[model samples]
Every structure is written in structure tokens, then in C-alpha cells.
Target: MCPSKVAEGGQRGWIVPIGGAEDKENDKRVLRRFLELCGGDGAEIAVIPTASRLNETGDRYEQIFGGMGARNVHVLDFDTRRDAHERNRVARIEQASGIFITGGNQLRLSTILGGTPVAQAIRACNAHGIPVGGTSAGAGILSEHMIAGGDSETETPRANGVRLAPGLGLTNRVVIDQHFRQRDRLGRLLAALAYNPFAIGLGVDEDTAAFIGPDNVVEVEGSGAVTVVDADGLQFSSMAQVDGDSPVCMLGVQLHILTAGASYNLVTRKASAGELSTVKE
Candidate 1:
């Protein structure tokens, strides 16, 4: 995994990627932690709800953040690519102490914010030690390589089982998959790894999150688990030999399942537990 870029005297913000369906009302362990990392009350938090089709998604999170003591909460919503250029909106992100992105179609988020000034601001926040968090599709957009979409019903390794798309590039070390176990996305997550073996595959379960620090250690939290796939030892892949979405053969892949309190070092490619499990890749 590539080391993340640094800023502000070699400091970087925490990148928190939450799987879909995080508990907003009850418990709210994951969201609350993100707020704490952002410096809690009075922090200027920016909520990006560009991915959702629903009009209320932005307001809903705005209320949530405000209710959680972020009196200075701003809901930055945009429709077309033109909206991304709004100087006032981009400035809010640039000055935000913390940023949260809501879940929806990841493609919409990428197409609208990718390469824009607003996206550039978000990256700056992270590099400057301001926490940037996202859930579901929001989580997918934080990585350099995002899982677009593909068949989720099966676990077979296929050349075309998953699609890849460019994301915000906040993190180049990992490819994210949300609502992982619930959606049976192991196949596609592994397929993404097969296609880009250089990047690690991170499959996060519902209500959970992976808080990756500048140190590249991911601290797992919330209910359910996080699946880490390391293709560093991959010996072979039949991607070139496959045709028409056919299942492909692969070898030497490692799998590690982690839960709350467990952590994984992205730099070392090692899980909290010493033993590394093998999948049928």
C-alpha cells in the first residue's frame, strides 16, 4: 500500500469509511467517534450529501450533526457539475474542521465532485489533520480506486465480476466495498483486488467503520466486521486468460477478518491477529 500524502508540517487527518446503515439515533458509536476526532462541539463541520437522490438527505445529516453539538454545521449540496464551482460552498469545505459525506450512488458523487475545487478542498482537509468521514457510497468515494458495481449474488472470482472507477484519491492503499457481508460483496471485492493487486481490498460491514490513521493502521469499530484482502503475495491471476465475464483462477491471496477493537497495519499488510487466512481465490 502506498503511503498517503502529508501536509501541514507532515500531519494528515483520519480517514473514516463507514459501511452503509450506520446507526444515527441509537448508540451512534461510529458517528460519535468521527465527531470526537474532528474536535467535537463547535467544530465547523461540512456535510456533503451530493450522492443521494433524496432531497432530505442533506438536511437529515445537517440536523444530526447540529444536534450532536456542531452548531456550525453546513450542508453542502450540489446537483450538476456547475454547482461544484460555487465559491461559497467550496470555501465552506476548505475551512471545515470536519467533513462528512452521506451515502447514495457513488457514481453521482464522483462525477459531480471528482476533480473539482470542492473535492480538492476535501483532500486538503485530510492532509491538514481535519477528519473526513463517509458512509456507504460515500465511503467508496474516499479511495483512489472505487468499486463501481457488479454481480453480488455469487462469490466466484471472475474477470468481470466487479467494475472499477476513479474516486477522490484520499486513500490509494485500499479499495472500499460497503454493506459488505449483507450484500455478499466478497466476490466483487476480491475481483477488484485481482484486477489491481497493488491496492488492498477493504470490505466493511453495515454499521461498522475502518478508521485509518496517517500511520496506515486501520482501527475497526461498530457492529459487524471488516474484511481485509491482501494480494501482496498473489502468485498468479488469469485476468488475461478470461473471456466474457468468465470465472478466473487466482493464487496466493490472503484474507483477514477483523472486528471492533482489532486493527490492521496497511503498510505491513498484517492484521491484529498473527494468522493470515487463505481464501478460495
Candidate 2:
């Protein structure tokens, strides 16, 4: 079990970006680890499913969390920007032990909740020792720059293959892409980095997750692997000169494929395949 983020009393929390279609029926190790980090037992979990249009999406998570042993699990719905400001609604976010964002349309999450107090409150919680987690579109919006859409079929990087947008401003360290290998998104992800070599590119596969620790180490979990693209030594890029439809030219890019138990240091730009030990308190 992971140490309780809430009990840390101000030890900046973690950002959990889970690839889409996690196994909710089985062990659900990813979600289970998230719950453990949230403080378990009587943990108060808040589910945000605004990105999804399906009315049952939020409620379904509420039930899932409850069944998983969360004593207080509720779905928070802020229909519009105005609803985001409601004190009662914002309070729900502020007082939560854990925050979980469900999968859907990333654009909806950006347009509706981008600048609202609800977004601010969630940020506050994470900044003050509360674990925040998301899946799929939820994962996409957890980063500072999000991959809104791109060519999923292409295996080679193209100048116009990827689209970028502002996200929740959680971390500017990495740009997240979901269903990575399963959907063949390497080309688009590489293209995204070409636009800004400063930010690293993280490609998360289905049933997998990248648990970005406060210490800047991303611990991989689940069955699939997480691809880390480090463009730190990027010598040149054709982002400005290449045609929109042409293949991009680049130099000095590093990539790492990490499976369960492996970790990557965002700050050091290094990879480690060491096993991870459970945290106990």
C-alpha cells in the first residue's frame, strides 16, 4: 500500500495518469493504488466526470469507488462555468481526500473547467497533499500541454500530425498521450515534442498508468508499458521549416520503454528498471 497523501500534511501530492480502459472488474491495481495513496478506509473520493456526456458516467464511478471500499464517494457535476463557482460545489473539491477524473472529451474538460474555481480547488488539493488521478481524456488534461487530437494511423512523425492545447496546468514537465502503442500514436507524440522540445512526451498504454511522484519520478504500473521521449539533446527540428504534411526532421532524441516496476526520473532524464517496494505507515 502507498502512504496516505492526506496524512502527509502538506507533502505535495502525486499526479496519476492512467491509460484508457483499465481493468475495473479485476484487481484494478492502478485505481487500487490511487485509493491507497488517498488514505484508504474512510477516504472521501470525489469523481469528476464532466468530460463525458453520458449521464451515467459520473455515477458509475461513484459506485465503483464505493464498492472498492471508499466510504464517502460522490460524483461532482459542474454543468457550466457558472456552476464551477458555486461555493457548495467548490467546497466539495476542497474537502475531498482524493480526486478522480473520468475519461471523455478533452476539449470539454478544457473549455468548461479550465479556468473555473473548481479547477483551482482541485489544483489546491493536489498542491496541499491530495492525490489526483485521471484516465484517458482525464489523463490527457492532467498535463500542462495536452494532445487534443492527431493522426493516429501514422507511424512516422509529420509536421501537422499532432495538435496541442492548454490543459489543467498540473505539470509542464510532460505532454501525455493515451492508448499509445495500441493506437500507434508514436508519430503524433514525436511531432508534439517537435513543437516544443522543452517538454517531455509521455505515451501511456491501455491498462497501464504513470504515477508521477512529487519527487519527479514516474513509477509505471499495470500490464502495458509507458513510453518516455526525452528531447533534451534535441539539436535541430524542422518544425518551423517543414511543410505541414511532410515528415519532421530531428536530431538527438531519447526514448525509453518502461514496464511495471520501472521508473523514470523527469528531472534527471534517466530510466531505472528496479523493482518498487510498497509503502507502509
Candidate 3:
């Protein structure tokens, strides 16, 4: 296992990846959890709504977080890549206790924030143990390699069904898919794993979340489940071996379905059985 990234004398910040459509008005369990990890009523949060084109997207989260008792909340909005690269624009992120990214379009989030100073600042803050949370498209960009967009309802794994793109690179070895069961995204996520078998595939259902610790211990929370697809031991027909839009043939893939309170260790690739149980990879 890798050593914890928590700074000396400080608690390790969390990575909260939420599937879209979380209830902000009712229980607000997901957002509440984020606030708790971010330091409760004293939390300083940065809200990035760049994924959504709507003018009010950022405001909506600002209001939500404010009502949740965040001491300070700032919305970082950038109209262009030039604005995204401005150090002044992203300076607030460096001082924040946590950052929340809203849902809309993953491509917009990546194209605007990728390789920019703001993205760098986020990576730096996360390294220093600042919790970062995102929902829907926001959740998709938490990994180094992200599923940009895909055909959700496909029954088979098509070679070109899913689109891949560069993301925030917060987590190094997993690909995230949001609104998993709600949208029937299993096939799409499976296709992504087929293309990048070395990484674990996480399909998070709507209203659910996976809180990843600095040591890569992921604890599922909220109403739905998280589906973990491990393709490490899989035998598959190569993408190059097939022509046109044929389904990829795969074997020996391991799948685990986890609900709230269940945890998984990214380092050992094992699921915990109440007390950190170990499973064969």
C-alpha cells in the first residue's frame, strides 16, 4: 500500500466523486458529506461550473454551498482558455479547503481547464490534502484518462462507442462513469475498460458517490451503488483485430457491485469485507 498523503499533523482531504442528479433540496447527503470533509461550517470552498454553459449553473451551487454552512465560497468562471490560464483567476483555488465542480459537459471542462494554471492549482491543492468534489461531467474528469462521451444504451462493447480524453488527473489509475445504472452505461464503461484495461473502471450510479481517501481507499455513499469493473486478468480481442464497429470480445473480467459503506482499496485492487478484506487480483 502507498503511504498516506495527509500532511504531517493534518487530516487527509478526500476525493468525492458523485454521480449526477444528487438531491440538493431534500437530504443533500452527497453535498453534506462534501462539506463535512471540507471542514464543516468553517470550510472555504471553490465552485467550478465551467462544465455547464448556462449562466446560472455556478450561482446555483454557490447558493447551495452557502446554505450548507460554508464560511467562504467562490465561483470560478472562465469564458475562454485564456481566462482559464490566468493565475489571478485561479488564485482563490489555492487557498480553498475544498473545490466542487458542477455537471454539464465534460469536454468543456477539459478543453478549458486542461493544462491551464487553474487546473495546475487544483492539482497542487489536492496534493496538499484539499478535498475536491465533482458531479456528473465533473466526476468524469477526476481521472487522468476520462470518458468524454459515449453511447450509453448499447448492449455490446463497440470499438468506437466511447470517446476518451485527458482529465484533471486527480486519480492515476481509474476511469469514472457517472449516472451509471440510471442511464444503462455499463456497456460504455466496459468498452472503455477494453480500450484501457490497465485502469480500473468505476461506474457510479445516480445520487451515489465514492469518497476516495489520500491512500486510495474508496468508500461508497448515498442512495445507489458503485460498480467496479476490473479487467486486469481479461483476455480480449484487440481493437485492431476487429474491423468497423464490431463488439470487443473479452473474457475473465472481474466485476464487483458495492453499496453505501462498502470500501475498496485502489492499491491492492481489493474490496473490504467489513474489515478491509483482501481479494485476489
TM-score of each: 0.94, 0.93, 0.91
Better of 2 and 3 by lDDT: 2
> What is the alpha-carbon lDDT for the whole of candidate 1?
0.88
Candidate 2 vs 3: which has more TM-score: 2
- C-alpha lDDT score of every prediction, in listed order: 0.88, 0.88, 0.85
Please provide, for model 3 over 1-281, each residue's C-alpha lDDT reduced to its tens digit, 9 standing for 90 to 100: 12224467765467788999988898998889989999989999999999998999899998898998999889999778999878777888988999999999999989888888888888778878899999999999888888988788775777787888888888767889999989988878888888768889889999999899877888888899999988888886466576457887878788888887788888899986553244446
Q: TM-score of model 2 relative to the true fold?
A: 0.93
Candidate 2 residue lDDT tens string, 11-115: 667899999998888998888888888888778998999889999999888877888899898799767888888999889889899999999998988889987
Kindly list the per-residue Cα lDDT of model 1 for residues 149-183, writing each as its tens digit: 98786777787898999888888999999999999
Q: How much is the lDDT of residue 13 in candidate 2?
A: 79
Q: Model 2, poorest ten-residue lDDT window?
A: 1-10
Candidate 2 Cα deviation (angstroms), residue 21: 0.3
- Residue 32 of model 1, lDDT score: 84
Cα error of candidate 2 at position 133, Å:
0.6
